[model samples]
Target: MFTNDTPRQGLLGRFVAGLARTRQGLAGQIGRLFGANVPSAEDLEALEEALIAADFGPALAQQLMTPLHQRLSRRDLSNLDQVEAALKRGILDILSGVAPPPSTMDHQTRPQVLLFLGINGSGKTTTIGKLASRLITEGGRVVLAGADTFRAAAIEQLGLWGQRVGADVICHQAGADPSAVVFDAVQAACSRGASHLLIDTAGRLHTKRNLMEELKKIQRVVSRQMPDAPHERIMVLDATSGLNALVQARHFHEAVGLTGLILTKLDGTAKGGVVVAIADQLKLPITFVGLGEGVDDLQPFVPETFTDALFARS
Candidate 1:
């Protein structure tokens, strides 16, 4: 996995490689517009269209371009470098508008609890495993709670990850009470002196009302034992879901007040700009981004790195 010790260029290269599809979509458009020209008003308009095409949403696309349009009219934007620089600046401003997530392992709160939420097929479980693997590799003990008891396969999947990562897993039989599993997981993590407790909750979106209330119940269960616990209510969203990913974040944030996001499936999606839309609209910071299937691919979300990779020529 990637750590702070990793070199900057190597890390940026990994991000660029992962965002190839997205770069091909958005950066491709920018490349077409900037060329050797000073970029006319019509050219800027076309770039705005490309932003929307990349799933930045119409409102944000316009918001991002309006300033460049003004600078262009005032003859401030001189060349291709200025155009790309202006766009990258606009993106970083929005992405860093919110504060970053707090430290993952707070010693005072031993067993820093993290709960993962998302709709089915959002790569929620896999993200948890990858994150837990990183935590353990960092010399932190992790106890995983398999609260997604709705599906037998989910419980089994979590167990497999637990074994693979050498973390203890607390799960119940399929269809068992999810809260009960959480209650036990909290106790296990506390007793074992674990540094973190990661819970994988059910993603049964079809049971809408029940699922939302169930998530709230899980929070309550964790709080009863360790107040201010469940320290991170992070949503694991699929970047490929596009606008629907934004919609999913809205629901989870409204229901249980999500603390941050971990976007997955960025490896093959051209709609990675949805990352911008989610952050711009919801004000939730993205914690991690899944670039590939390997555990090492889940890199900590770096706003500058992501923006550079997004705007890099494909």
Candidate 2:
């Protein structure tokens, strides 16, 4: 419904296209009912099914449809415009509850520490670089600690990004203690008078006890280096991972009190609605979102801009 070559389309085109494909799985069943003057029980049932199948989850899909269903119950009920309006409003209402973005720090300490945590392939390391780049662009000196010493490639990747963004990165050899690397990074940041210290921890599995312990050790040492350090513990989640993402989030939040979330792969995922579900479920601020694969792709999560992208006219 959003293809008109209208200039207002802008990002809405890409947003709709991304979500529309996911909707295709249910389009056949719900397409005919949509924009119809009087939708049948089959139509409403199909609509609900579509939402659930899209991985909005059962509770969320029902909550999204509650208002629509309530209004559609009236016998005076109306045309396709009414149905479309109801559906749009219902989805928008649920999104309206989404919380705001993370606030910038006041840099109370010598070097403010922001720890990045997530499972393997959760995009934790890159998010550290992205954040560091942002801090640099804002005129804040940043020092990155390649604390994921278990993976040689992780260190190399972080170092590469640090150079690209013109930030200093501290690292040690593979098999080196991760905590030790964090200690060095914090010391370097403090010694150099850097404003921010972004630490990239090993992307360990939530099921791995040893890995979780290593993270705790890293945090303990970082705090000792600069009390009140690690001002924020950010968890990076893959938006495309669907329901599993929420489970991962719960584990991370349990492991380390997650101060906020950095949802990556949003531009490439139709399950972007999961952001709303996460927000409604955890209520943690979505600190950042990866819109594309660029140094500047990551942006502070803005609730209304995101909602506009999700349901804006394409």
Task: Please give the range of 10 consecutive residues that has the lowest summed lDDT in model 2.
Answer: 1-10
Q: What is the C-alpha lDDT profile of model 1 across 1-314, one tens digit per residue?
A: 22453467877898899888988887677677766678888888888888898899999999998998888888888887887788889899999875373353344688899999999888888988988898899888999999999889999999998999889999999999999999999999999999999999998847789899999999999999999888889999999989999998998888889988989989979998899998899998787889998878888888888898887765
Error of 1 at 156 (Å): 1.0
Task: Give the whole-model CA lDDT for all candidates, comma-separated.
Answer: 0.87, 0.74
Per-candidate TM-scores read 0.95, 0.86
Q: What lDDT would candidate 2 get against the real structure?
A: 0.74
Worst 10 residues of 1 by lDDT: 98-107
True-vs-predicted CA distance for residue 294, candidate 1, Å: 1.4
lDDT score at residue 155, model 1, on the 0-100 scale = 97
Candidate 1 collision pairs: none
